[model samples]
Target: MSDSENPVDIFRGFLQVLKSFQILIILTALTGLALLVTNGMIDGDWGRLSGGWANVKIFLSESLPLDWQVIEARSYPVCEQEIEFFCSTAYIGMLETIKIAFVATVFGFIGAILLSSLAARNLSPTWLSILVRIILSALRSLPSLIWAILFVIVVGLGPLAGVLAMTFYTIGYLGKLQYEAIEGMESAPLEASRATGLSHPEIFTNVVIPQTGNHLLSQMMFMFEYNVRHGTVIGIVGAGGIGYFINNYLKLFMYSRVFSLLIIIFVVVVIIDLLSMAIRSFVNDQGDVRRPSWFTVLLPAKNAVEIHHGSAGEEES
Candidate 1:
């Protein structure tokens, strides 16, 4: 009957949890299999054909000379000369990449605020929260590549297409992330704001928005990082960036140029990582893992307080 000898309670709890999880797992697996079969992915013709994988490998070995060019034997001066083209194109491409990411992050951050404010379960009505959630979901359902492709068609290539595509895509994704962050926040401060005759909009601006700004900015940085990675490939769809260099060099079988462009991308990503980390460290106040979502926004209003009758229950334990 003692706590240490609670075998019956443990057995029943474990069995119920296991049974529930087993049912969920089985349904997920069956649905996955059904989708594969419905899509013809389970067709024997698709799997039975070994195709020309082996033949293609043999053909390449036969066609290409075994004693063909080596990097050391090829003119070192000529290799160095080729490297310059990659560096130049890659530098310009990298700059454009930064521009696209900046636009995307900025746009998404603004959009996240508006959407997240409306979607906040504590600060907004159920209808507003649901509407914001639906809008965010619709925006996020499509990959950024589709936006990039669509913009490429409308804008006719260049960084403009890349920027627009990345911007809208970021808005959709960040809006949802920020909304969830807001919902996960502690309700005490918001409730205090509400108790003081602060309107929903006022509570959001004074309490929720201020508290969540850092989390929002962190999400924006994450979105920016994603944009930097994705924006490069969007150029493949005629949205000008490093992907264009990759495509052009790959088509001509210029692995050296491709390699150089890849190096440029790595350098840019490294720089972005360093900058973002520094900014985050500077903005973060509490330095705790479980930071309140709206802490950054509240930093500015540190002296501001909402009078409440009894807040002892809500204080940190």
Candidate 2:
């Protein structure tokens, strides 16, 4: 029988096609569901969406000639530093946010590592893992914003509240990520360690940590960036950060100042992302193949991927 006509060959071809299109099919289904839900929420009044552009235009008209004043020293600040910008609200607020995020991320990473070791099924008994998982879940159940509100009430408004809120949320989030990474580690090292009669703590420290170190670092960096972004939000409720100034500008309808601050935040976020990528490259296997650069990151994905492959091919050749 011809290969094309063979039933087994036909079935194999069908399976290959299904496998190739599986992701596309899933995305299409998800998109359709999202559209349906959005339509219902809007009550089919698509016409109401037409005013969005008009409102945007109005906003831009007021926010145009982006305010540079935010970077200048405030009058009360009495610019004592060599640079006036150092005394600006933007610098102070953003610095506070970074401090809060940094403290929280560091503290949270330590806490998560401890809890995740216990939660990892490969490292701990099933009962212990389940219990640890429950504790992590309870911590994660409340969003960071809610945590910020609670802390604000407890601590009476400041960066302290922001720090505590972000730390708690980070612990829960990073704990789940850490345990999953631990679980996904190769079983050979773990089995060898256990066979050698190493204790759970020793096995975890020597084997699991080294094996999953790259992933854990990546997660910690991600959590830090996440906390930085959330720092802005928590500040709105007087948790202390750039969001405090943002809230003030918003209340005063100073859209221009708000827009400027947003641009600053956007710049900082981009810088953080680039730094994260560079740092990860140092430890990731792909670092030897191709290291990332600012220009590569700014380029479109298709072009960046093509450039990466081209470089890799050249290296091999």
| lDDT, model 1 | 0.73
Looking at candidate 2, the ten consecutive residues that score lowest on lDDT are 286-295
Could you give candidate 1's per-residue lDDT for residues 1-317 as a string of tens digits? 88646998788888888887997889999999987886686464654347668877675564444221221223333445544543356655666777888887887778778887888777678998899888888878878889888988898778888888887788788888887888888888877777788887778777776777677667777788788888778978888776876787677776656665666677777877777777777557746543333534464444222212123236643
Q: What are the per-residue Cα lDDT tens digits for candidate 2 across 93-127?
A: 99999999999999999999999999999888999
TM-score of each: 0.65, 0.87
List pairs with backbone clashes in candidate 2.
none
**Sliding window of 10 residues with minimal summed lDDT for model 1:** 66-75
Off by over 4 Å in 1: 1-87, 285-317
